[model samples]
Target: MTSAPLAGCILAGGLARRMGGGDKTLLPLSGAPMLARVISRLQPQVGAVVLNANGDAGRFSRFGLPVVADPIEGFAGPLAGVLAGLRWARAHHGEAEGVISVAGDTPFYPADLAARLMEARGPDAGRIVLAKSDGHMHPVFGYWPVSVADSLERFLREGTTRKVLAFVNLHPNTAADFTPEAGAPDPFFNINTPEDLEAAEARARIEA
Candidate 1:
């Protein structure tokens, strides 16, 4: 657990353009929906989990989590999803001091994600901590403080660029390095295409 309570947010709003446009997270991974694997990894690390998605929330009903859409419309990018998650945590998970945002298609995220993020924080109360693997920062797998809800909303509503790093860079932020286990892929490896999914399965097989 974090020194402060935390909520989990799975960002699933991407259009999956490279994969022919659809919910890529719902696609199969090792005989089960990829998102099911995501939930399993993240659920243990936070107080509660919410799905950040857009359109037809009913499609995710089976997951039995509150589905929140980006507060700003027009597929405002992962930053919007992060903003939505922060607002939702502030409103519903009021006890949560922050929210952890994970990319829904990235099923291999580290199991100790939340704990490492908390460790990466400075003495401040609301530092943003992102995951780093092999020197690359995965901003989508981030810890966002509920206190940044208003600033994030303003960033989405007011800024022309919607990149997650743009806003994250504006604040106190650091990355928690994750060393790949022997025979394992980078923890933040995500499936974005048919070939990528095949590669993921092959990698999973190697690890198994």
Candidate 2:
């Protein structure tokens, strides 16, 4: 099946407590900002791409993409970032049916990520499609229907649970399994600490 038209959003609103409480996405991974590498792969997969981040937007001006903050305050997590993306897509590109969200710190996500998610969703536009690997689910990386924006906003305001899995369980969902090439780093490798960044740099050099 062909992929659906999806607007991409890089979720970069995390506190990054494990990485010394700053924007982990801005950290250099192999001589480039992590967000830049993410956009390089994600741009072709979707109609448009936006950065879902909090605080000063000027820091990301170099990327030349729309910067959107979560609609809810106090950094509500990936779900809020997804909502922001959904809203932005609806406002800026009405033709997009949904948003494919990926972690900004995860630069090695597959180039076919959106295509696989859309393929998994098939004809059901309302179904939430996420990525899975090695028997683990990555809820932050998913295709969420723009129609669920209202429901998600309500879910955030009405409940204390900020977990993406808990919110996704409220609706029909599918997981697209991905396996990396032999000897290649895991496609979902994310940089949350100095060690992860170092490992990613080594992998980047090897993969380069």
Candidate 3:
């Protein structure tokens, strides 16, 4: 089934407590900021891409993409970031059918990530598509229908669990499986600590 064009968002709204309370996406991996690597992979895959982050937006001015903060106060987790992207896309890119979300700290996600999710969703405008790898579900890496923006807003306002999977399961959804290559780590592997950064460099040497 033909898929509609999508708007993309890198979810960087986390407080990054695991990495010592700073913008983890701005940290360097292989001599480049981690967010730059994510942007390089996602930019070509969607119609428009934005950074969903909190705090001073000026820090991300060099990226030159629109920076959207969580609509709800406090660090509301990935679901809030997804909602921000959905609302932004609905407002700015009316031609887009949905929003594709990715973790900002994950640099090596598949280049065809958005394409696969859109295909899994088929022509169904309301279906959510999530990516899975090695029996683990990556809820944040998903395709969300823009039409459900209202539903999500209510979900957040109600202040139940802020878990992404809980909300995604409430809607019709499909998972696209991604198998890891031999000797390579899962593409969704993200950096959340100094050791993870070291590990990413090690993998980059083999994969890059």
Candidate 4:
């Protein structure tokens, strides 16, 4: 089946408490900002791309992509970033069928991510799609319907402050599994702490 038309959003608005409260997306990974690498990977796969950030959108203006903030208040987490992205997609790419959300810190995201997730969606099933690696689901890296904004808003309103997986499970969705290949590490590796950054640098060196 043909894949749906998708727009991409890099979730960069997280309160990086674990990374010492700085913009993790702007952190250097292999000499380039992690956000740049992520945009490079996602731009070719989706119709449009935007950065979802809360404070000082000007910090990301150099990328020349539109910056969107959470429509809800107080750093509600990735789900808020997703909601901002959905609204941005609807406003900017009105023809887009769905929005594919990816973490800015994940630079090695699968190149076929959009196609794979779109393929997993079925008629009558909810419009959420998650990625799986090593038997664990990565709900943040997935496709979401633009229509889900209302439901997500309600969830935020009810103070349902849980991780993305909990929200996904409450809806109907499928997980697309991917296994490591040819000594390659998992495509969903995320750099949250300094140790992860070191490992990712080593992995990049090896790949290079």
Best lDDT among the predictions, by candidate number: 3
- Clash pairs, candidate 3, are none
Q: Residues 1-208, candidate 2: write the lDDT tens digits.
A: 1356779899999888999998888898888888889999989898899999998999899999999999998878899999999999999999889998999989989988888888889899999999998889988898999989998999999998989988889999889988666765689988888999999898889889
RMSD of 4: 2.1
Runs of candidate 4 exceeding 4 Å displacement: 1-3, 122-126
What TM-score would you give candidate 1 relative to the actual structure?
A: 0.94
Ranking by lDDT: 3, 2, 1, 4
- Please give the lDDT score at residue 182 for candidate 3: 77
Tell me the TM-score of each prediction against the true structure. 0.94, 0.95, 0.96, 0.91
Which residue runs of candidate 3 sit more than 4 Å off their true CA positions?
A: 1-3
Q: lDDT score of model 1? A: 0.88
Task: Give the whole-model CA lDDT for all candidates, comma-separated.
Answer: 0.88, 0.89, 0.89, 0.84
Candidate 1, residue 200: Cα displacement in angstroms equals: 1.8
Supply the TM-score for candidate 2.
Answer: 0.95
Question: Sorted on TM-score, highest at the top, how do the candidates line up?
Answer: 3, 2, 1, 4
As for model 3, its CA RMSD to the true structure in angstroms is 1.6
Candidate 3 per-residue lDDT over residues 74-178, each given as its tens digit = 878899999999999989999989999999999999999988998788878899999999889999899999988998989988957988888888999999988
User: Lowest lDDT 10-mer window, candidate 2?
Assistant: 1-10
